[model samples]
Structures are given as structure tokens and as C-alpha cells.
Target chain A: MTDISRDVDQQKYNQALEKFVSSVNGNTAFDGDFQGNIKPYQINQRMLALNVLRNNFPTVEKILGESVFTSLAQVYGKYYPSTWWDVNIFGDQFAEFLASQINSAKADAYNWALIAEIAQLEYAFIDRYYYPGHDSTPEVLIEFSHFDYEAQQLIKENHPNLVITYNCLDRFQSTANGEKFHSSHWSVDSSQKSKLKIFSASVFRQNFQVVSAFSCSTANL
Target chain B: MSSIDSFAGKQCSLGVEYMGAGLGLRFPHIYEILSQKPKINWLEIHICNFINGGLNQQLLYELSEHYPLSFHGVSLNLGGPEPIDVAYLQRLKQLTNELQPKLVSEHACFTSFDGRSYHDLLPVPYTQKSVEHFCRRIEQVQETIGRPILIENLSRYVQYSENEFSEAEFLSQLCQRTGCGLLLDLTNAYVNDKNLGISIDAFIDALPHQFIKEIHLAGFSTHDEWLIDTHSAEIPQEIWNLLELYLDRYHNVSVLIERDNNIPSFQELYNECCHAQSILDKYPS
Candidate 1:
């Protein structure tokens, strides 16, 4: 730790930093005309959050372009406006947001489902970027063994055009101690330029099996 | 002794050290910076971004090996009428211990209120009681981090009607009381000058030269009649002139160029640093 220096009155430095501030707020012993409006701060925050979200989900922004993306970003902010300073929690629901846009015929340039898929992929990569990698991945077709019945049901019921829950992410998400990342659906074989195998329920079953394999790595994209 | 009780004689302020002109290390510019290894004086980061361990943190450690680094934070909320989070400061302290940045800083303004983070620096009302308010928080931060911090004045939309002292006087008292230093952000001064009619030159003159440990030079955007310190565009000539005014007396203060929005290409930003570097080279220790 850097060297700390404190030489203020004890009567003033009342509580711990947070507790002290609260007491100060209550005491009202200090009188000043510091009337702060929260609106300007809110406006700036919306802009900052959008810029950061654009960085976090580049593919979504690039596909939607500036005008479309800004519109989507405003809508995204309205729904999930919690500060994205922590990158992990910022875009957790972005894919869902994109998918909802399609339902409303808002983004009709291309396949919105495909765009949602891209968002999911990008978010997973970002999550992977934060968690980092400790395991080495081979550049071959690898089997993922962590899928439960619901995951298999989603793939099997959706048929050939199903939203494949990129299983590689489930096996590799190593959450940090006490970090609050709730979603565990994105992983990358981060060691080398490795092939990311996306397994669908139609392709895999009770046993580890693959009927059709697709290279869905962000590298290929 | 109660944790709230001041750490008896545990305070130690770091001495003045300058590393020419520097740039805020943004995530988008990191990969290119790693590969290209551009010529730059130093790097300042938001501190919160790298506190959580990840590839960015790992890369930051690698970058620290090659450049002089400083930690600039936004969450301290030193001027807010709320409790400062102890856990946040401890995490910050952990990173400070691991990286050992030469200079560590937070704005003199509050960032978060109640539980919601405003996510932008709000102005602190300059009054005698608020001076004590600012001092106690700065002392708490200094006490927690075990280092004297440089308090940067913020850019805001409004000035208080009950401002007892000018920004310079308020900051001077805080420095005298708590042993803290000032990070004179010239662009913020320029904004407050234009928007609030406070004379920038007068503010600079009133501040003790010994207390100004660092200089922050950046660009601001115009909002109707007000000048917003948006750090988005290239460094304006007016802000550069302010740096000249500040550099006239204060030397060996580290200069940093900040860009938090509409960040341009690395070459463009790095070239802007050359401009500040040119000015720094004009003045010598």
C-alpha cells in the first residue's frame, strides 16, 4: 500500500469513511449553497454507458451501425441502466435485448436471431476476456460434457435452427472469488488460436456424441 | 483503538515526482500499445478498471514494467454527503501495494450519492464546513491508502451561491489541514471559468505552488453557453494556453492528457501527447 497521511480533527473524522460521510450529511452543521442537479449527471452517465456498451459489444454496434446502435443503446439503457463500469455485468442481458428488438421489427437489416447469436458470442468472449484462461484447448473437435437435460432439451426441441448454448463456455467459466457475475455462458480457448466447437442438443445426447460440428470461434467470425 | 479513530501517526505522504507528459491508458489502445511500444512519458488509468484481476490486469502489470504509472480513481466520492465505502478503498489499497504507482488520485468532487453512482464528477460546494468535510474525507483516503493524494478539481454545470472561498482557497485549506496535494486540471479550471465566471488565472495564483504536485491538460466541448470538460476531442489551444500559464511557475509536476469519450486512434492520441511533450520540454527542472 502507498503511504497514507492523515492530520484532521478527531471530532470531525467521526466514523469510517462511509459512516462519517452519512453523519456529516445529517449534522448539517456546514451550510453551503451546493445545490446539485442529478439530471446532468444522469445525462452524462447515459452517454458514458452507451460508449462503454459499444466497446463491450463491438460486433453488435458494427452491424447495427451508429444511428441504429445508438437507438438500441437508448432502449437498452432504459431497461438495464445499471452502471457498466464493471464490464462483466454490463452486457449480460444485451443478447436478450437484441432478440427483443427483432420481435418488435426494430432491427430488420439481417437475421435478428443471428444478430442475437452474435451478441451472445461477443458477450461470452468479453466474459472470457475478464475471467481469462488457465486451460489449454486443442484445435480439434472436442466434446463438452457439462450439459444438463434442459440444455439438451433446448437444442433437441429447436431442431436444426436451434439457439445452441455454446457449451465450451459452461465448462471453462472460472468465477473470481466474491465477484458477482451471474451468467456462466461464455468461454474461449484463450491459450492459442484454437477451434471453438459449438455442440447442439440435436447433435449430442445422454452420451458425449457429435453428429454435426460448426467452428463458431470469434476468430472465424 | 476504533477503526474510525484516526490511525495514530500512520500517515506518510509521498514526495513530489514528475514523469513528463502522460496519457490515460484506455483498453482499446492497449493491444496496439503492447505491440508497437510507442514513445510516451507515462500512463494514468482509472484504477477501478484494473483492480479486478483479469487479462487487462495482467497486461497492465506488463505495461507498468515499461512505463511510469499513476492510478486515477473516480469512486472516492470525497465531496459527497454520504458514507465512503471502506471495501472499495481497501481494494484500491491492494492494487496500490501491488503496482506501486508513483502518484494516486481522486477528484475533490463526489461521484456516487445514496447508493446510485452518478458516474460523473459533480462539483463540490466551496464553504468552510465543506472544507472540513473535504479534509476529513481526504484524510480518511490518505489514512487508508497510506499516501497523500492529489485532489483534482471537477468540471460541473453549476456553481454554488454560497461558495465561501474560491476553489483555490478551499483547496489550499484542505492541503494545509490534511497534507494532501492538488492535481490541477486546467481544462476543468477553464470550464469553471467560462461557465461560472470564476477567473482561472486568479484561482491558479491563489493556490500555493508547493501544493500543486501534478498538471492535467485536456480538451472540453461546448454545451450551449457552458463548456463541458468532455475529454473527447483533440486538446484545444485555450487549454494549452492554460497549461502554459500553469507551467510558468509550477515545474516538475507530472502532466497527463485524458480522453474518456470519442477516443481517436492511438497515433492521433499519441501525436497529441507530442504537443504536450513539446510544452513540457520547453520547461526544465
Candidate 2:
């Protein structure tokens, strides 16, 4: 083939590929057999991001057992495979997908928030472990003061890689052992002056360890 | 949390085998892994909520007392334009200190950009700015974790115009500059090969094998001829061939199987592990 023809063919092929991708991704409507004449082996080459199944069937894990959950996931996977690369975020319309399924209402009856909260909790837990902290310098120290005192206290307490803004001051307490930091309350002491403090919060050795003391004085106390 | 044994030239915990291959330990299989005890060399603890909301640390400590762990995580969102989540980092550090994992891993993809989290590992244009930004984030992560991490290659659907470097070269440079290891996801590489018209061999050849500390193998389904790394299903034959190729070329490599959904029975997964082990045995390390 001539160079001009090859270029035209390549351009056409790219256009077809793009259209097929758009159709599968649900970006564009696909009325025809989108898989085309691709070989069965070739069909397996197409990518299906799990985000679609995750978002679509968040509670499938609870209503149905994991085995059934996965079988259902496969059905959805065939019908609405994700075209995006980020598998974790692909299942945006999963709830809608559930509603379309057999007895999906019953499944939806299950506390999705609980499932989501669990997933979020799980994600956050793993995230806290792999998360990295910033430099503990004096300049950087000032920025931490903007955080609420109760939060500061909590940081001083359980140095778990979690961000819980104190809902009340009852939540904060300095542990005697210096190793154990626990907080049941999230509220801050509004009366105590918001003083700057250099709290050394470390996610060291699989523990949320902290060493904190006030950096600035409170005139009230 | 609990005392673990330091094996010859390496470390070992009670139930956790350091045979090298790993899989992201998920909730569905928790009982199975603990009860049936599928023999995994390493268990990649997903770092989503291990250190949050006052979950009993003693349970995990007990698990660690019994098993050796390596952490695998999402939500780092390093490419997110917002300032690094310091609270997140602090919690991560605490967990790492507890686990003392063989290695911790995260995606090379950015989760958020410009402060708005897409909550996905979105692709970045392989530009000089991106390279520098990514390196800086990795440096910060290493500093926070007090150790380096292996950043996995992402399976992307789109390309950013800002990209100037090939994925391999970018990873090679990132490892060289930051002293970070590469979590080479063969399935992701295969996906990129189909999507981006890259030669898989050349892409592998570009990276120095020494920088590749870990390998990821998983099943992928297709959409419009694009191979998506979904971490569901069994490992595809093509990917197995690719794995064999990778093993043949790189020895002493730590490998893993990632099954996010369609989780089979522990027995079934053990069969898959055996398959992988046989391949590894052929090429040792």
C-alpha cells in the first residue's frame, strides 16, 4: 500500500477503535455489536475495571454471599464493563445497576452506607498505614497549630494515621505511658486558648505514637 | 506489636511466609487466610483503614505476631494538587512501624488533581514537571514511611499530551532518582501495549531489572480491544506467558497475584499459586 493509503487506513482504524472504546465505556451509545468480528481470544483482551462492579454492587457482598456476589458482578461486568483505567472509581452507577437486577430492592435494603462506611474504613485503614508524613521543622510546626486543640491532643494521644476533628474536648487526654494515645470524644475545649503546640505525631513501628507539649502559652490559664 | 523472628538474610513472622509472592489481603478472605491459611509468601495489607476509627490494634498485632506482612495501598493521591494529607501520612507511618513490611506499594497514578479528588489513579502527562513532582512526592513518602516504597504502574485509558517519556524510562528514572523500587504490573504493561502501541519487549528492556523489586500478575477483561487490568478472574494464558518471560529474564524477583473480585476458594487460589510457583521454580528467584 502507498504511504498515503497506509496513513488513511491507520487513521480509520484508530477512529474505529476509539468509537468501540467509547461505546463500551458508555461514553457513547452502542446500538450495534460493538465487539465486532474480533476473535474470542481478542475479546478477552478488552479491559474491565472493577470500579464499575464496586460502585454498582456495593452491597452485593452482604445480601448475597461472596460467591453469588462475584457471579452477579460478572453479569454486570458483561453488561457494563468500565472503559476507564481507574478500576477503583469505575462503578459510579452501581447502585442503579443493582436496582435493575433481580430482587435488587432487597439488596438495596441492606445498609449500603454501612457497606460504604466499611469500605471507606478499610480504605482509610490501609491508607493510614501506607501514608507518609511531612517534615517536623519549626516552620512546619506552626502550620499544625491551625488544627484544633482537641485534634492536637488526639494526635498527642493515639497517633493512628487517621484524621478525626474533635467534636468535643471530652475526647482529648494525655496518656501517662507516652505510648498509648486514645480518644473517645472529638469536641475541643473552647475555653482553652488556641495555643500553638509542637506535637510529635509519628506512625512509627506500626503504632500511632505521639509526643506533644504546648509551644505557646495560654494567657487565660 | 508481637516479637517476630529475623530469618537468615531475611525476616519471617509466624504464619506469614516470605516466599516472595503476595496478594492484597482483603476482608472476604480474612477468615480463609487465617483459618485455611493459604500459603502466601507475603500478604499485602491494603492500607485503607488498618489504623483508623479505633479498630482493635491488638487483633492486627496478633495477626502480625502470627504472620509477616507487606502493605499495599491506594488513596495516597500523591498527584493530587492539594498539599499532601499529613494526617494520612502519620497514620500510615504508625502502621508501617508496626508491620515492618517487606515493602509497601501504591499506584503511580494520581488520585486527585487540582484539589478535586477523582478518587482514581488518573494518568499524568509524562512531562518534566510531572516527573519532578512525582519524584518529590515519592521522596516525601519515603521520608514519612522512613523507607522507600514500590509504586505500581497504572492501567490508563487516556494519554496526557504533557507526557514525553515512555513508561519504562519514566519508571527507570523515578527509581534511579528517588531510590524507589518499581512494582512492575505485567498486566498493566500489557494493557498499555494494546492501548498505546508500545512494544512490550522494548518497554521491559528499557527498565533495569534490578530496579524492579516486585511483580504483579492479574486477570484483565477487555473493552474495545483495550486490555483492562481488573485484578479479577484467573490469570490469562497470555499474561502467564508474559510472567514466564519476565521470570526467565529476571531472577530472585518477588511476584504476586492480585484477585480483587471474583474471589475463588482458598483451595482454588492455592492451585493458582502452585501454577505460579512451578513457573518460578523453572527460573528460580
Candidate 3:
């Protein structure tokens, strides 16, 4: 084929594919839409996206309930369309989407913050589960004591890849306290601040299992 | 030489294999497979699952040590209009070089078009134009990977009006043009037959028999009058019958039982493999 014919063919394919993508994304006005099953196909596409979201963010799904979760997932599907071939990576930006949604909602500020933290935690787990480190050495076996005190401190300061931490301790503790108070009383005052306890936890994959270690603020170095 | 040797020699001559029967390596059954060292002939794995370097990659390396592996991928959208994703192909090539799988395969359908990807196997119109475009992409992929890849048939819910060729005719012409092999998915064919009123026999008969290098057997579910290829449940009896009919003609093909969701115990999947083996055992290669 001549270069001119090749360009024409390429143009035709691009046009057809654009129509198909639009139709699949629920723009049913495209000429390439499935003859009689466009509506059903659209529904199936949404369900596929929702299923991926639920799988990736089980905690968020449970907290938001199915109805609300499905509504949010549909909106997310439309706003943040899948750009990768692997659906596993399709929900990479979902935590940010949840944060935006929570900010827009007219819910209790404390409860919504807790929900957003849960989304962050769940998305982190999903990302860690799939993209764990390439090193063959076990993370738990790494000895910080082997190096001198100054070297160890430098390593701890510079080596960001050594740990996966979610700095949501305050939110986690507050949510627990709020749930405890809500079990006995109908409502808890959002203005009342609980005792602040700062801590950190490192979640890592060891022996094909997710393991974590927590250190409280009072622990001696 | 033993019968197995003869079969292997013949298959190797064709640049493929007759890896008698196998099962998809699911994470749930990874421990059992690694520890027990089951008597299965080979294993098929979704290549995308192990693309990222992690515990999964380590496990895959170990599994390759025990059993011959075949890499099946879901992300290579060969039928799409855009130039195939070069980055994906590079990663795939890296994995292929590491595993040195007995066979590598992807679907004949497209999963992405333009900049957006559906993440599901979407059907391509079976027109002459589509066939040419799809074959050109397949040729490009083969050139990039430095090896021929098998293309599997998809179980589709809709067909385009502009389609000028049957699925089999398109596949046969594709193989003729690009020298690619076929991964005849019996469950997909059965589902498409029931859902679209296409004749399964005609579909199978349309393909060039020698190009069929692999076979996939899986289960489907019925949802709102549509037979969905969920690969969740056990291989139904009708699909088994279809397998028997397929084996009658093609004896030198690797068969794999795939279960992705609602996975059963390892014993149950092993029994399914044994059942497929019994059918393959019925006909001498």
C-alpha cells in the first residue's frame, strides 16, 4: 500500500475506535454502538469498573455500604476513566477520588476524615500487594544494629524505600474512640478532642504475607 | 523412544508443544503446587499477574523450576487501532526472556482503543479491513518479540454488521498471513455458540487444524439470559463433551483448565485436570 492509502486506513481505524470507546463509556449517540444491546453493554462496563473498585477497596466498600459505594464508583468511573490495560492498575487514583468526594459531601467532618483515611490505607495495601520490592532479602532480617550509630541514622534518614508507612494514627484512634462512644450514646461531639498519642507502623511483605510492626512515641530508641 | 518422547519430538518440530494437560496457576493453590509437586504435565499462568517484581515474581520463578510454563496474557490489545503499547511489549519481552515459556498467547480481541483501555477483551469487527489491520499488528508484535504468539478466540456478546468473515475464517486467514498459532478456547466457543446462535462445529471446522497449538477449558455462568464466561465454576458437562469432540480431531495440543474466581480446593482442580487427562488419554497422540 502507498503511504497515502496507509494514512487513510489509519484514519478510518482511529475514527471507528474513537466511536467504540465513546459508546462503551456510555455515550450511546455514536454510530459504532452495539445495535440493540448498547444499554446493557454500558451497564456491564460500569459493573466491571465497580467490581474492580470493590476488590481494591474492600474497607471503603464496607464503610460506605453497597448502594453509596456503587454510586460513588459510577461517578469515579466516568471521571477517571481507565487508561491502562490492566484493571488492577485502574484504581491507582481512587484514593484521591475518594478524598475529593469526602470533601464535597455534607457529612460529619470527623467521620468523613476517617473514611478518607480508610481509603488511603486500603489503596496503599493494594499498591503494596502488587508492587512489592525486587530485593530477594527478607525485610524483617535487615539489621540496623550492624552499622555504626551515625551511619544507621543516616540510612534511616535517607532510605525512604525501607518502609511503607501510613501516617493515619490520629484518624485511626479517633475513629475507634468515636465508634466506642457511638455504641453507647446516639451521637458524639466532634469538637471534643481525644488524648493525642503519636505512633508509627511499618507494613512490609515477608514470606508472602503482609506483616507490620508498631512503635509508640514512648518507646526508647 | 517412549510415546511421550515421540509426541514431544513431533510438537517441537512445529515450534510448539503438546503439553498434555495442565491447570492455571492461581495464588490460592500456589502453596499446594509448590509443596506437593503435583503430577500435572505443565502449568499456564496469566503473565500480567507477575509483571511487577515482587513475591509473585519470586513464586513464578520457583514454579518455573518445577513445571514447564506457558505465558497467557490479557493486556496485549492486538486488534485495537493504536500502535501496540511499546512499553507493555518491552515488559512482556523481559518476562518472556526470563521464563522461556513453552508458548506465549494473547487474545484476538482488543482491550484498548485510542488512549482509553477497557481492561476487558472487546471484540473486533470481522471485516476484511479489520483482518488486515489486526494481522499487521500481530506481525509487528511477532517481529518485536522475536517469536510467534498464539491468538485466542473471544466469547463475545455482540457482532458488528460490517463483519464479512466468520471468526474461524478470520483466524485462519490471520494465521496464514502472520504464521501465528491458535489458542482454541472451547468454553469461549461454547458460550458464543449459545449466546449468538453460531454453530460450534462450523466454528471449529473453519480453522486450520494444524495451527491449533493450545486449548483452554473453563466454566461459564448464566446471568439475565446471557451466558457469561466468568471462569468461576467447574467445567460443565457440555463443555467436556465439546472437549471430547475437539480432541477427536486435534490430538497434539496443550489443554489447560482455568478457574479465576470462586476457586475450589486444589483437589477439585486436580480432579478436573485428571478428567481432561483421561479424555486426552483416550486418544493416542
Candidate 4:
């Protein structure tokens, strides 16, 4: 084909693909988007993004049931569609997304700020998990007996990759951890901060494992 | 199944056996694959999973020691309009240099567009312009990696309203232009056959036999009333039938039983691989 015809053909493909991308992404609809059932394609993208969310934000998935988690993932994905090549890093903005949703009354399923904080902790967990710490597991483990007040600062200085995330340790645990806290107890709204004395929740690796081990500041206090 | 004998020595691939059946290495089976080390032909790796230094990366290195690994990537987005992602390519090049995998493959679909990345594989249009565009990208990839890579066909929900070439014709031209091989996915062809009226038989028959280097057999699930390529459940009878059809024409090519989600015990997936191996045993090698 000649240059002129090729250029026209290229322009046509670019236009078609741009509309297809926007439509599948739920941004805008054009006449006859692509050809066939695009709903499944859209659904599949959400499912793929959910797998990434489940990996990065396990605490969020656990606190929210499977159905709720799936819905949250789809909605979160539409707002902040991933721009990272690695799906493992897809949910970097999710903790903030959850906080935004709850603050805006878009999601009132859980009234407490703990859910969002757990998401914050989970994000840190994934970051530390992906951090190029060591090819092999580190020989020494972090001991809890070392620090009283200045531990967070000291640990940050020592391990630059270490992440100390979130406060209000107990409420997040009560909702997310093994023993189910009563639903009535899960009403610690962020607005009522002084009513409940929130404890600090710092995540650290007990061993070299990627899964984060949680600790509270009550003992430190 | 002509040998890549010319390309193998310098690359350290050294004539991949194309053992009738292989398994996609997923995280669930890592420990079992490490400890139990079940009998299998070869293993395919998701290139993105091992890029950053993580437990999965460590595990992949360990697994590479045991089996001949193939790097199959979803994030390259070669079919998309974005200029080649230099950082991603560099990481892939580093990983390829480190692992010395038997084969490296990416999809013929777009996973990113308009400055945003997508996790799922989206379809590429079958126009001559698209063919030329992807060829330039594929050639760039080959020049960067110093080896030809196979492009896998995607199981898509929609087809473009207008096409200058059929899927088969497009793939054939793509390989001829860029010197890449085809990762013929029978499961995807089955999905397209059932969801759209595209024929797997015609797709296979039309392709030049030499271009097919690997075959993928994956499970599809019906979600939201449409047959989606979930790779999360059991492979249906129709996909198995398609595999038999594929094996009849082709021999000594790598075949992988791909299961990403709803992963079964390693033994169960291995059993499915063995089932594929049994069918291969029936045919002449």
C-alpha cells in the first residue's frame, strides 16, 4: 500500500481503538462500540484487577466479605484504573480510595475508620513485600523487646524499607482478625476521635516472611 | 516443529524438547513444586511476577534450576499504541539474561492504552495498519532481547466490525514480517468459536505450520452470561477436543495446561497435564 492509504488506515485503527478503550473503561460510550458483547470483557478486567487487590490488600478483602470485596474492587478500579505494568502494584491508591468512599458516605457498609486504616496497613505490607530487601531471608528477626518510645524513628533509620503504618490498632484487629468483634463495637467513627483513645498500629516483619506481623502501641506506652 | 537450533546455543535455550505437555507455574504450587518436584515436561512463567525482588522472584529462581522455564508475559502491551515501555523491556531483558529461559512469549493483544495500564489482555484490530504497527513493535522487541518471541492469541469477547485480514491471516503475516513464532492457544480459539462465530479449525488450518512453536490449553468460565477466559476452572470437553485436533497436525511442540485462579492441588493439575501427555503419546512423535 502507498503511504497515504497506510496513513489513513492507521488513523482509522487509532480512532476505533481509542473509543473501544474508553468504552471498556466505562469512561464514555460511542455508537456500536467494537462489535460484540463488551460486558464480559469489562467484567473480566474487573476480575483481573480484583486479583491484584486481593493480593495487595488482604486485610481489606478479609474485613469485607467476598461479594462486597468484588464490588469494592470494581468501583475502586473505575476511579483509579491501574497505570502500573505490574498488577501486583495495582492497589497503591486503594487505602485512600476506601477512606474517600467512607468519608463521602458512598460506602456506609462499615462505619468505622479501622477498615480504611487496615487498607493502609495492607498497602505498606505489599510495598515491603516487593521491596528488594534480600535475595535470601535475613538471618536476624526484629524483636519487640527493644523499644519504648523512639522505636519507630530508630527502626526507620536502620531499615529504610521498613514501613510503620496506621493508628487505632484495636478496632482494626477487632474487625479484621480471627475472633469476630460484635457489629455494635465497630462504630468508632473518625469524627469521634476523642471519644475513643486510638492506639498506634505499626506493621513490621517478625521474620523475613512477606506477610506483615502487626503490633500495637499499648505495650510501648 | 523445526528446531530453533540456530537461535538456541547463544541464547542458552539449546533446542527445547517441546515435550508434549507442560504446566504454567503459579504461586500455589510453588512449595509443592519445590519439595515434591512432580514429574513434568516444562514450565511457563509469568514474566511480570518475578520482576521485583520478592518471594515469588526467589521461588522462580529456585524453580528455574529444576525445570526449563518459559517466560510468558501479559504486560508488554505490544499491540497497544504506546511507544515501547523501555523500563519494562529492560527488566525483561535482565530477567531473561538471568534465567536463560527456553522460550519467551507475549500476547498479540493490548493490555495498555492512552497512558494507562490494564491487567487483562484486550483484542487488537485485524487491519493491515495494525499488522504493520505491531510488526515494528515486535521487531523492536526482538532487537532488544536478541531473540524471536512467540505471540499468543487472546480469547476475546469482541471482534472489530471491519477487518482487513482474518485472525489466522493476520497472525501468519505477523510472524512472516517480524520473525516471531505463534503460541497457538486452542482454549482461546474455542472461546472465540463459541462466543463469536470464528472457527478454530479454519484458524489452525490457515496458519503456516512452521510458525506454531507452543500451544496453550486453558480453562474458560461463563461469567455474567458470557463465556469468559477465566483460566480458573476445569477445561471443558470442547477445549480438549480442540487440543486433540491441534496435536493431530502438530508434533514435538510445547503444550501447557494453564490454570491461574481457583488453582487445584499440584497433583490435580499434573494429572491434567498427564492427560494431555497421554493424548500426545497416542500420536507419532
> Which candidate wins on TM-score?
3
Please give the ranking of all candidate structures by lDDT, highest first, separated by commas.
Answer: 3, 4, 1, 2
iRMS of every model, one decimal? 8.7, 12.5, 3.3, 3.6
TM-score-superior candidate, 1 or 2: 1
Steric clashes per prediction? 7, 55, 0, 0
True contacts kept of each: 0.23, 0.00, 0.36, 0.63
Q: What would the per-residue lDDT of candidate 1 be over residues B129-170, giving only the tens digit for each residue?
A: 678788888889888888898888777665566567888888
The global Cα lDDT (0 to 1) of model 3 is 0.72
Q: Tell me the tens digit of each residue's lDDT in model 2 across A17-116.
A: 3454444335676545232222322233233334334443333454455665666566666666543323444445554554455455455545543343
Q: Give model 1's docking category.
A: incorrect
lDDT of 3 by residue, B163-199 (tens): 7799999998788777788999999999888888888
lDDT of 1 at B60: 71
> What are the DockQ scores of the candidates, in order?
0.16, 0.03, 0.26, 0.35
Off by over 4 Å in 2: A1-221, B1-18, B53-59
Question: In model 3, which runs have C-alpha deviations exceeding 4 angstroms?
Answer: A29-40, A136-208, A214-221, B1-14
Model 1, residue A67: distance off in Å is 5.1
- TM-scores of chain B alone in all candidate structures, in the order given: 0.92, 0.88, 0.93, 0.92
Candidate 2 vs 3: which has more TM-score: 3
Chain A TM-scores, candidates in order: 0.45, 0.35, 0.60, 0.54
Residue A150, candidate 3: Cα error in Å is 32
TM match of model 4 to true structure: 0.79
lDDT of 3 by residue, A1-221 (tens): 88898778667656666666677675647454443344445666878779888887776676677888898898888888888776775677776777676557545432555555555545544554456354543332111111122222322343323343333454347767864422211122233222112222233333444343322122112
